[model samples]
Target: MLTSANLLLWAVLQLALLILLQEAFAWWIIAIYALLLLYSATAVLQKRSAASLKLANIVAALLTLALLLNMRQAGVLHFMLQILLLSAILRLFAMRHRHEARQLVWVQYFLIASCFILHQDMLLALVIMLLFGANCYSHYKLFAPAGARLNFTLTGRAVLIILPLWLGMFLLFPRLPPFWQIPNAKIASTGLSDSLDPGSIEQLVQDDRLAFRAEFSGTLPERQQLYWRSYLYEHFDGRTWQVHPQRRQQAVAPPTTAADVATASYRIIAEANQQRNLFALGMPYSSSQGVKIGSGGLIVADKVVSQRFSYSIESALAPLPLQSEREREMNLQLAAGNPKTSEFAAALRQQHNDTEQFIAALAAFFNQQDFYYSLTPPPLGRDSIDQFLFQTRSGFCGHYASATAVLLRHAGIPARVVGGYLGGDWHPQQGYLAVRQREAHAWVEYYSQGHWQHFDPTAAVAPERILQSLDMSLSDDERDMLIPFWQRSSVLQLLSLQLMHLDYYWSVWVLGFDDRSQQDLWRTLRQHIRLIAYSAVAIVLLLLAGMGLWLLHRRRLSKPLPAKQLLLKALKPALKNKAPAQSVSACLNELAKRYPNHAAMLQQLVQYYELAVYAGQPQAEHSLKRLLQQHKSSLAALNRAIKNT
Candidate 1:
């Protein structure tokens, strides 16, 4: 019976944790839990007899196998969860002993430990509290009588007392890293990617998913200028752009000039995306811990970040003149086969004297011509740049930037596609800028004079996109508006920003504090060794004192009698000792002869005491006091009376 009860409890715990975590195997666990409930009901119908319960138990085990099959896609941790759940269900249905029950109890604990891997949110912590309380209640009920109506109340108090101790242990416990790495369940990837494909930023625009968080050391850049750079794509395949692996370059030292060093400084707290690209401002010169400088003056991770990561960077947004011939050549290289664009560029070069004049002329034409910024564009065929530039002047940032970069390259000017966010919404509460996926944009960076000069040709056609972002540039009826006005209203926007801050803390201080954090924590602890030692001694002393008090209180409460009742008990032994002879008649006769003055009182009291004693209600108080007062004479009389009788 105990075994069955324990198993039932264990199964319930597993079901609860699974539901709370919202694991991928939710349906399987639900089905198994239902099966167990059905089997339990059937056993109850058979009056809980062991032999009749076998069929129900067997069916439950089979359902467990079904559960495993259902959770095949959930990976190993989920598989273990299924196995343990099924074992608990089987144990409960076939339970016949206490040992099995104890095993089930440990199984429940193991299930809880598994929850730490699945989720570590605050809500899960509350659920664990309830499970722990239930465990204690079950143990209490095993020994407590059914009539003890205060059992729940007492159990609640015990749980309250136990909670702090358990928390203390939890907090002080040395958390070990996972024994072996478990296969990670796929979560959403955030931030930018190396390849820019269709539908890449489609769903991401609708996502409120956080990409990364930043904390500035000084004044922050305006939302319109919060262009966090990740990667630069130089290869274009007409419809999509890609970063070539072979062409990947490292960062070079910027020219040391007064104006060239102008930049903003800040720190970033980036979330894990299992990608190597790290976002910084315009041009970063230095980076914080764990970040590596890449060939393109970008920060690359030593490994794919699988946890929340933080880094600081120094960036310069100031313009610098192009100097290196190799850098310029690399930027200008485009796949050599578009005759129309090559011819158009040659014609434009004939009209302009220099590279600077060519760039200015192109920007002037885009501004004065029938160019219009539209999200939807007509399909471009083989000569995409030629079609976009000469015919369909109506295009989004992608079209404008791609055409501009190709034109500059054809004109013998070094240019590449710069991929990053164009603008952001400033969040007051978070003190940071929020750049969503829709803010994703591309522009041209061409080597001009002596350094790379950022040139946004889209600015000529859609100036508002550069000033307020694509989101704010579009009105309610506009096709390019990602968020409705009501959603982006200041009130709603403030609430979202606050939520982001909370998410930031949860990602950093809570969820992100892992093995490396533990090492830092231990280092800090070692520095304050005296404080830790004192706290340890104080806790031990407090525990010892509390135990002593509890023991004393228990010893006192176990006995019901008071001091008065104890005095009556003491008098019985004294009175029995005073009897001179074993014979009752002789003791009485001797008492009458030797102490005649007290004989009447003695006889009357003894008779009354005997009657009351036989009736099981001794008039203990008055009789006990009278016997004490006459003890000396009565004893002498009783000695003589014993011999005479």
Candidate 2:
């Protein structure tokens, strides 16, 4: 039968594996793992023997094959994780003795550590810490005495002692890049994509999840100025808009001097979206490492952003450079549909010959017409732009931007729809702007005389959206669709905002603390080198003193106590008149007769004392101490009775 200690250790090991891999693995894999754990627990409870090596080998082989087949879909990282978890589980099923499970426990430790690769937020980090503690307990239980239970007090004390050392190492240690980059798993990309279709951005705007955060080095920009451009949709089919293939293949453009002095310098901390496209304002120039300056002043990561990424950028609010002949041609090409909208654009162009005046007229059309911004727009056919312009005037930002870009192109002006975020909630206390997926917006950038100018027809339709937030422009019903029912309460909204603030600080101080932060720490330490050295010396002395005291206490505990001395101390109350050299047996016999209440205990004590002193048995000394303790109150009563007499 398995010992209770072993069973407990087994349970902890399985729990650690589950908690670590639950988020990373497929649901079916996790369900299978849970079922196996249940089976193992049932066998342990029933006192049945562990699975035979043959059965374990069969399961291992099947799981290995399944993982290999899934490797392509899950990627190499998840495949390795699955294999590691499988080995650990199979090892447990095949083991009969606790000692045989030692290697499995170590594997669980590694699995728990690997969880940080996917999750680094504050809440998940705490969960990971608890998993570590559970794994540590399991490892300790492997060599501990049978039936030993976990001592929470000792565990907490150990954590308290080690926490400082952990912090010290984390702060002081030189941060080095990973020795080898782990392959990114196939995760669903989160934000905008290379193509924009009708209702695509409308669906995205309903999601309130955080996309990225920006920390400005200078004064915060105006609400209308925070248009974070991510992707440009140059090619327009009748129904969808996509990035031109040649645009992506073009080389990085040379930096151009800004026409205006207005610039915003900021650092962006973007959540992992599994794409190389990054967010920035107009005409961004970045020298940040691990990022590339793409054509048309676009920023892109050197690799897929499989984790949280940070980059610093300086963006000029001026117009972009003049479009190349190929770019103008690409942006001007339109599908052979929306002829009614084309005729309307051509007539408007005829009324205003100037490019700027034509653009103004297009914006005026959206403003003067009965256009309503709605997340749920009516579906359109092949002539989407024509229908949206005349029949279905209700649409989201994508509809407005698409119609405006199409109108501009029809009027012989090179224009494209820009996909990115619009307004962000600026937390003045935190000094950062939080941009969410709900802020996903689409606008237009038209190539005019010498430069490209940004235009948003949605702003002309609903100016409050640019002036404030999406909520301001939306009705209660539309706003409710974006926010959850639970968060509609005023109290819950305030609480949620506070939690976001806490998370922001955690991300900035902990997850965002990179090699540059370490270098800054080193520089600060060098400036106060003498103070740091003194503090270090003081800490070392204190640690040495604590160790010296602990060693002394241990030495005192290790020294053996003499049996004769212990007997004398135990019987001092009853031996007031006894001779100093009296035989222990005689003394016990006299005491047993005088205090009959403790006669049995006195006799047992004398026997143990003799065994300890003459037979030299260590266990006898322990027995003597225990016997004396059992009869302590009676012996005291005997002493008091003698005193009264």
Candidate 3:
């Protein structure tokens, strides 16, 4: 029968695997794994025998086939995870002897370590640590089968002993790149895509997940200046706006702009979005390693952002570069639909001949009209711009930006919709700006006065969105629809903000500690090398002195007591008269019998000797010394009397 310890080990193993691989596999696969775990736990609780070898092999074959069939969909990373977890479960199911269980525990250690590849959040790290402790306990109980329990004191002592070594290796060791590239799992990407449908950004508005964080080197920019551009949508199909094919194919090195004294310098710590596009403010002039400037001044990563990524950038809050003739032609091209809206745009253009005047007219039309900014907008028809402009007049940032871009194009101006995030929550105390999914916004960039100018028709209708946040601009009903119920209360909202702050610190200090950080640490150590050397020498000397003192004290404790030494010395005369093999008790007995008048005192001496030496009584030694000292002359006379007799 499997002991309770073995059952606990298996339980923790299954839980760790589930938490690690739940996002990698499909629901059905997870269901199968969970069901198998439940069945095994039930059997172990009821003290059922282990499955036969043949039955275990059959089940393993089935699981292997399932995993192989799902490999393509799960990708290489998740496929490996599934294979590891399946093997562990099968081993546990067939575990009978101590050796097999030992092998299973070792496999579990690898599985737990693999969890870091998928998750690196502080809370998840703590959970992984707990799982490690549980596995260690299980391993301990394997050998110590007599009612094994967790010994926190011993565990703590072991940790204390190993902590310095672990820290030294972590800090002083070289931070090398991975020997092999790990494949990213097939996970869904978050944040903005290259295309902008009418309701795409509206869907994002309901999701409050973090997108990225920006820490500035100097003072923070105005809330309205925080337009984080990621992608430019130039191709409009009357309903959806997407990037032109030429833009993707024609990625050239960004022209270096002279850095102004007031240039904004900052670092962005972006969450995994599984996409190549990155976010930046205004026009990025220069970026750190592993990132490049792509077409239209957009930032692109060297690889897919499959993990948390940090990069520094210097950007100039200036007008974008002039568009090429091909870009102008592509942005000005409008689809065949939206004819009514086209006529309206032409009439408005006829009133204002200048491009700036025409753009102002369009903004005034949106602000003056009975247009509503909402998360839940009505669906559009074949011509989404027409329906949103003339009929419905109610939509989100995507609708307004789309209609405005199309209107500018109809009026002979080259215009495109820019998809990215807008205002962020600036945390002054934390020294970073947190941009979430709800801030996902779209605006228009129109070519005017020899350069591309940033414009937001949505800002004309909802100025609060540019000045504050999405929640501030939204109504109570819209806010309710965007935010979850738990965040409605002030207490819960503050608690959530606090947790986010903590996660930000974890991302910066722990996950963000890379090669550059280590180099900086080494540089600092070198600068203070002399002081460190002196401190080390002083510490060594102090330790040696302490050890010498401890050894001397132990030697003193191991030696004979002073009272016993005195007793041995006083009995030398009497012992010389007795036979060599005779014990001190026999010599004392002879003296007591001969000195009958002083027999009580001699007898007392014998009792004291027996109690102090044989019985190991400390107080009896003091009594013996007192009696011997009080009757020193009498004892000597008794000794002489015994010698004469």
* Cα TM-score per model: 0.64, 0.81, 0.87
What is candidate 3's lDDT per residue for 1-645, written digit by digit as tens?
A: 348656756866676678676988889888878877776777788888667778889988988898889988889899988888887877777667878888888888888898888887788888888888878877787777576677789879989999999988877799989999877788888989978998999999888999999999988987778999999999988899998999998746555565453468999999989999999988788898989888888999999998889999988887687647787788999898999899998999899989999988988998999999988889999988888988999999999999999999999999999999997888989999999998899999999886789999988898888887888778899988987888889999999899899999999988888888889999999999999999999999999999999999999998766655665666666666678688777777777786687788878887988888888899998899999899888877776775776
Point out where model 3 deviates above 4 Å: 148-150, 259-261, 542-645
> What 10-residue stretch in candidate 3 is worst by lDDT?
253-262
Query: Cα lDDT of model 3 overall?
Result: 0.85
Best by lDDT: 3
Candidate that beats the other on lDDT, 2 or 3, i.e. the better one: 3
Clashes of 1: 10
Worst 10 residues of 2 by lDDT: 1-10
Top-TM-score candidate index: 3
**Candidate 2 Cα lDDT to native:** 0.84
Per-residue error for 21 in candidate 2, Å, reads 3.6
Residue 469, candidate 3: C-alpha displacement in angstroms: 1.3
Task: List lDDT for all candidates, in order.
Answer: 0.66, 0.84, 0.85
lDDT tens digits, residue span 1-645, model 2: 336566656666676667666656888888878777777777777877778989999888887887788788898898888888877777777778655678877887888888888876677788888878777776777678877888889879988999999998888888887899778888779999999999999889988888999999999888888999889999887889999899988766676665556988899999889999998887886547778778777788999987788888988877788647787788889899899999998899899999989878878888998999888889999899999999999999999999999999899999999999997998888898999999999999999877788899998999988998899888889888998989889999999888788888888888888888888998998999999899999999999999999999998887545886777676665554678698777888987897788788778888898899889899999888887687778767766776775
lDDT per residue as tens, model 1, 1-645: 343454456546655755754554566466756666566646645557433357746776686667667554666666677676666656666656666666766676676666666554445555787887676556554555654544567668987999999866544567876588766554335667777643344344545455666767677776545766777777766657788665565345553335645578776766567687877776677776688666556678776775667777877765545445666676767775667878878899999968788888889989999997765567777777777778876677767777888888888887887776666655556666555566667777888667777788977887887876675445455532556666667899777656666766666666656566667877998999999999999999999999999999999887633323333343333335554545443444455566677677556655645444444455653564566565756555544554564
- Reference-based lDDT, residue 151, model 2: 85
